[model samples]
Target: WLAKITLVENQVLLKYFVISASLAGIIFLKGAEGRICKTFSAISRLSNY
Candidate 1:
């Protein structure tokens, strides 16, 4: 019974870690996308000149 409880706890911890990691990844990707969009806009403006 003790082992079963430990197993359940470990699963919960693993799920928490996975969710946090996914959120971090999404934030990082969004940051990178913003930078890329800014760069593209700058390049387009320069070409227009």
Candidate 2:
């Protein structure tokens, strides 16, 4: 039935949204870590100088 099809489509869309959001979160976390590492390295170099 049309109603069943709509429900299935909605579920698929919801799953896709969840997966994309999780991926975005992981990317953001990695970016933050990279920034922190770069900052620490810079501080170390400055201290050495």
**TM-scores for the candidates:** 0.63, 0.60
Per-residue lDDT for 1-49 in model 2, tens only? 7666787799998999999999999999999999999999999999999
Tell me the tens digit of each residue's lDDT in model 1 across 1-49: 7566787798998999999999999999999999999999999999999
In model 1, pairs of residues that clash are: none
Off by over 4 Å in 2: 1-5, 38-49
| lDDT, model 1 | 0.94
Superposition-based RMSD of candidate 2 using all C-alpha atoms, in angstroms: 4.2
Worst 10 residues of 1 by lDDT: 1-10
Error of 1 at 37 (Å): 2.5
